[model samples]
Target: MNIITLYHGSGGKGTHELIDNIFYKYFYNKILDQQGDSSIINNINGRIAITTDSYVIEPIFFPGGDIGKLSVCGTVNDLAVVGAIPLYLTAGFIIEEGFDVNDLEKIAISMANAAKKAGVKIIAGDTKVVEKGKGDKIYINTAGIGSLRNDVNLGIANIEVGDKIIVSGTLGDHGTAILCKRQDLNFETEIESDCNALNGLIEEILNSKLKIRFMRDITRGGLATVLNEITNHREQGILLDQNCIPVREEVSGVCEILGVDPLYIANEGRVLVVVASEHSEKVLDIIRNNPLGKEAAVIGEVVKDKYGRVLLQTNIRGTRILDMAEAEIIPRIC
Candidate 1:
């Protein structure tokens, strides 16, 4: 039987055969080929950045991407937002017993394609199979390594009152798309997940020589949570112009129907960038020119306030306070 079984994960002949035939065959690289207890990688001269993430998005397959592609992009974006050039990635897969070998091959191919698109390599990986009922169809974990630019110094310490906040594009697309597909909620327009690698777009911004204070990918708690975190300890507060924020019509509709705030919804491809006010326009222009950032906009700015907070200037010329999500709105959303 070609299906994965307990024997395949038993650390014996079956395990070796599986590694030699499938894993090594697809993710072959000089460093990974060595197959030592740990992978040996060359040290970078400058600062090195490392990040890890796990993907357990329900359904495994979704409208725009699958768990495999998401795993690679998730890690790559994490490294990239910190002003790093992603170099290599290590993947760990957990598959359920009796899973289809053909589906596994498809996922492997998807991971390879995503890594190629992001200009990174999958240098190492591990595979394990669990009992059929003990696991979902599959789960993936990835770790990424990148080299940081010596000239770039980005962090909360750099954030100042007057810095502008820019979001890469529309919000909540990924979360809405996943929710719809998972619940079998049909809409006239099919919403696809905005699952993409943002390293290229971020690279463009970095090349423009803008003074970016900090950058974060809106993932779990969405933009609101990210903004709150950034302003938590600082004396400065964030003032967001609600009208300036970009939200897709379909995504907005889904959120309204489900009573979810787009600001609190997750996004896989969107980025929250804070730059000095003087360089905001140039930064916005650079982001707009990129395919992934065509809808980029300056949504808000940092302000001097007694208490660290996030305030939203409503469209009707009123203001309201926005805070971090008190509870989980959506779960298992990668």
Candidate 2:
């Protein structure tokens, strides 16, 4: 009974006990305590944004966070970047038979703590068990809902020539950390995943009255991919200064050894902010004031071009077209 078994997912006494002792123990709230099939959310009286994501990270536990924290943060960030104030979340778990109960509890605790920090509620969740060898230790899926701020207008359509592009923080930390853990690559400096909830930082920026054009959390496709995506089919291209983009030395070293570019690596907590040049400096100051955005920098800007493209100004005074990643750089990197 110390480990998860098929009976624990059978929706019987065992399943009820699991919910009472684990999920409810930490996530208990007036709304979720109702234990209904669908939790009712009352008094949400504005535009709402919703987003869903699944986490199947190779190592359930990483240096700075685990899959549980990643799941909540990822979903919350998705909603926040869309000019929303994250409010509620729903989680689903697929746990394999023979998984350690202690590990499961730890993950649940992580999720609960992350939810509390993000100031959101876990309104509902589901659990399922898979055959021992049929699944990984665990996989988590989360959906987030947030009330949209009426004052904010964010989209690619609002992007224009002379707009400034800002990145919240260092890139490739999450991807490099996962890669090191998976590949067992040892180095003098340890890389930790920058997995964190960005709702607070994002909300502050949105409330600053800046002309924020667009925002996106840098995830699977990395900064280059996001830039390429935003510039697609636009009249203006994006030009980036190579030196301004923040990349930890250790991360850069690992990318160099692996023959990869950090720009194409994934990040969990990082975001791309596109704002008009007039308000870019104020926006940067606001971002830097937050703990999650201490390393924020204005790395690029929109420029005139017939063909929308993302161009990087190399340190060697050469420019190159930065394209979307053709293939997955690292798989299962949340």
Off by over 4 Å in 1: none
- Per-residue lDDT, model 2, residue 173, is 97
Model 2 TM-score is 0.98
User: Tens digit of lDDT per residue, candidate 2, span 65-117?
Assistant: 99999999999999999999999999999999999999999999999999999
| Every model's TM-score | 0.96, 0.98
* lDDT string, candidate 1, 202-263, tens digits: 99998888799999999988999999999997799999999999998988998898888989
Residue 247 accuracy (lDDT) in model 2: 95
- For lDDT, the strongest prediction is 2
Using TM-score as the measure, the top candidate is: 2
C-alpha lDDT of residue 226 in model 2? 90
TM-score between model 1 and native: 0.96
> What are the candidates' C-alpha RMSDs?
1.4, 1.0
